[model samples]
Target: MSHPHSRRVRRGLIALAAVGGCALTTLVAVPASAAMTGSEKAADPASCPVAAEISQGYHDGHDGVDLAAPLGTPIFAAGPGTVTESGPASGYGQWIRIKHSDGAVTEYGHMNERFVNVGDTVTGGQRIASVGNEGQSTGPHLHFEVHRDGGTGFGDDPLAYMSERGVSLPCTP
Candidate 1:
């Protein structure tokens, strides 16, 4: 007759294997973009904040804010994240884009020089690029954009987001 102990052992092994499989899946299920170290996720934009106000301007059929600065003005990381894209992007001129762990991305465009390269991890205040007039710009100004999760395909209105941060914009009546 088959032993009851052996049946119990086989059942226990199957249960353990199932749990192990699930753990592996959980680890692998996380996207590479979302998998960030603790320090990277805790970045604050105010620390490496935009030190200048935006010049009134419009781009891509939307009103984008411009950070007016002298050429070669240090551009800091808006948030802790990895540089997924860097270099000239047609209308963007010389630009650097960081993808944060929260899926929010920041774009710094019209740069005179790029301090970081692609795949580089940067914290807030870390210099990523320099401001300049490039692409389709009117003058030396940094075109700043904050994009939401999976919203990197297009630009978002910085006015709305900046307003939420207690930055009031002048009403153009």
Candidate 2:
């Protein structure tokens, strides 16, 4: 039998690891069945982006639709656009920004990895980045923003914008 002190040390170690792991990756718990995906990978949902309910919406000054997805889930470009910004932003971790044909720019934030770069042109539904728990994110998700009138901050509601284009979310924002 192990000493009492050794047992206590083992338990302490396990507890510390658990806390650290939780801090590193916020599991955006969206059930596979509850998420909606327009991509062909629906047959293999594991590779798709499953947007969860907007935990935080525009009204709260969140500025984007928080789509809770698994870490590394591919984030597709919402429309055809030219990549304007790619890489880390203050609170947006590894992010990507695209300027669409409408002169409006969209930003994808908290990405684990980015597939595009500044000045690169991307098509609708093109893979741009993977979901992650970066920046101020409490959980792994894609913080997608739609900025209109060539502005920064105070953008349009991403849910309404994407919904108009036919990308359905599991819950209303």
Candidate 3:
């Protein structure tokens, strides 16, 4: 029989591949630029950006959607963007913040590892890091957020916004 560790590794690989496939499809379907709203038009999703609903729940501060996934599960870029910031910050443990060409910014926090460095261009659904429980978190999860350019304010609700665009999440608990 195969070793348990080996089996685990094999499963991890399969999971990674599945996640990658989804990201690739999301990138193609969204077409980065065409999916952009007024502000996003300048940036376009083409740079490869997409979001993953890691967990499930609700939070007022989070604008009412909670993504709950296992620790170390792959986290994908919501759309194509540049790694403008990738490091730890107050409240957010290991994190990566990407700036899309469309004057919008996406933040991924509670990361266990950062796969991409600052200044690197990342495509939507690309694996940027593993979900983690770094700072101010109760469990291993990712605190994802999006902000409009010039920091005017957050745009639409991330949960509804992503769903409206055709990205769907598995039922979470």
Candidate 4:
């Protein structure tokens, strides 16, 4: 035979426990959600270097795809990386190479102007250069390439590589 006051007190304690449990769950869930949000930002799709369709696809002896944009169109870094090379080449005229954390390297060639220098760290989508008709290019365009082994090996199909990283560069089938 519990007293009325005792019953009221027990109900109050139960209610308080339920509220405390909810608060605890919310506290635990918030940090997890925050961590995921941070990861999403880090894993954001690599930016397309140029805002133009692929003028040329990977085939035959072509090592990279060309994006035909007006001369001086800004080119961005496809992903976060450190600039390993940024200088004139025999065939590329002006080129920039970035080594990513995954050991892959991205190359941008025929740039009218390069904004970054060797050993410089750049973030994904950072403006690194601009389109140009430098080197052996026929007209103004950006030559983009991806290397699987930090530019030591042959180039890979950049379209497929960018696609795997959730970037859909404008291109025709």
Candidate 5:
């Protein structure tokens, strides 16, 4: 036989579990993404660029992230910035670099076509290029990099940088 105190505790636990289940159901029914407005969608990093999988991530020698997409897939700017460099590059084929107002620089490489040119002011999520198997790449992908000091050196981990900015890389479709 259960004690009175134990019975009360058990009843309370059951009630809490029922309430939690209802809350969980409600949460599952309403996806956060579905509720986002146009402005919020624009600010969403997923909408910023490369809505594909990460073929390669930042590593010791690899200072950028590789987003795998089909050839001709459009690539968008990661943030609002001025195009400082755009055109053929040594190991990047067609490359585009944008210098943001915060002194941070974003680079996109291995593109088949560059829509933006040097000195062009680009907004976040603007189409800047398309994926291609150009230069040193083995397949079609966008090699994306973020430099904190806006220098032509090894960049910091792009995933971390995006995360710090409340952005996530390789957004899913």
Candidate 6:
């Protein structure tokens, strides 16, 4: 999409869609990356969103795990869901949020780039974005969070929750 004509056409379509009062959804077909494995099943919150091996961990009151990764490292989805939001959010920087069928919503923040868009269906362990230092981040790492029962805030301890679901966190304290 580096060509000027391509960009112009895209912009023109977007403007036309807006004037028509329609939500412009540009569907992007993404191939599965090597970073992902295993098919999604049951829509359970039992699987790890990121790969099990993490550099950092979780903390008390921290709703998600901070996984240290290099910039542009692909980040995968933890479970099957529909993407609800994917854009810049305060303190989240560039983020992608998915609402799972099991009454849970998961968010991945501080990404350098997002591959999917709103209304995209994502499976567990599917590549969704590339890790980056964005928003309220100190370095290049992914900030992952899960909110239960479709709530927006007041996230529970992801370490304990993941551990109970059989996914271990790197946190010791």
The prediction achieving the highest lDDT against the true structure is 4
- Measured over all alpha carbons after superposition, the RMSD of each candidate to the real structure, in angstroms, is 15.9, 17.8, 15.7, 18.5, 13.9, 16.9
User: Where is the poorest 10-residue window by lDDT in model 5?
Assistant: 25-34
**Candidate 5 lDDT (Cα, whole model)?**
0.76
Candidate 1 C-alpha lDDT tens digits along 1-173: 74423423443455566777754333223345533454643443323335566577545555357878778777877657899889989987888888876667778788988989999998766878877888988888788777755343556556544443334432210
> In candidate 4, which residue ranges exceed 4 Å CA deviation?
1-45, 171-173
Query: Candidates' lDDT values, in order?
Result: 0.65, 0.67, 0.61, 0.78, 0.76, 0.69
In candidate 5 the C-alpha lDDT for residue 50 amounts to 79
lDDT of 4 by residue, 118-172 (tens): 9999998899998889999999999999885578645777886677676788732
The residue-by-residue lDDT of candidate 6 on 16-122, one tens digit each, is: 77698776635322233311233332335455555424655544446577887678877887677899999989997899988887667888899999999999998
Segments of candidate 2 deviating more than 4 angstroms: 1-53, 170-173
Clashing pairs in 2: none
Q: Please tell me which model should have the higher TM-score, number 2 or number 4.
A: 4
lDDT of 4 at 73: 91
Give candidate 5 regions above 4 Å deviation: 1-47
**Which parts of model 1 are misplaced by more than 4 Å?**
1-48, 57-60, 159-173
Please list all clashing residue pairs in model 1, or write none if there are none: 48-125, 54-66
TM-score of each: 0.63, 0.66, 0.62, 0.73, 0.72, 0.66
Q: Model 3: how far is 121 from its true place, Å?
A: 0.5
lDDT, residue 27, candidate 6: 39
At residue 25, give the lDDT of candidate 4: 35
lDDT of 2 at 145: 78
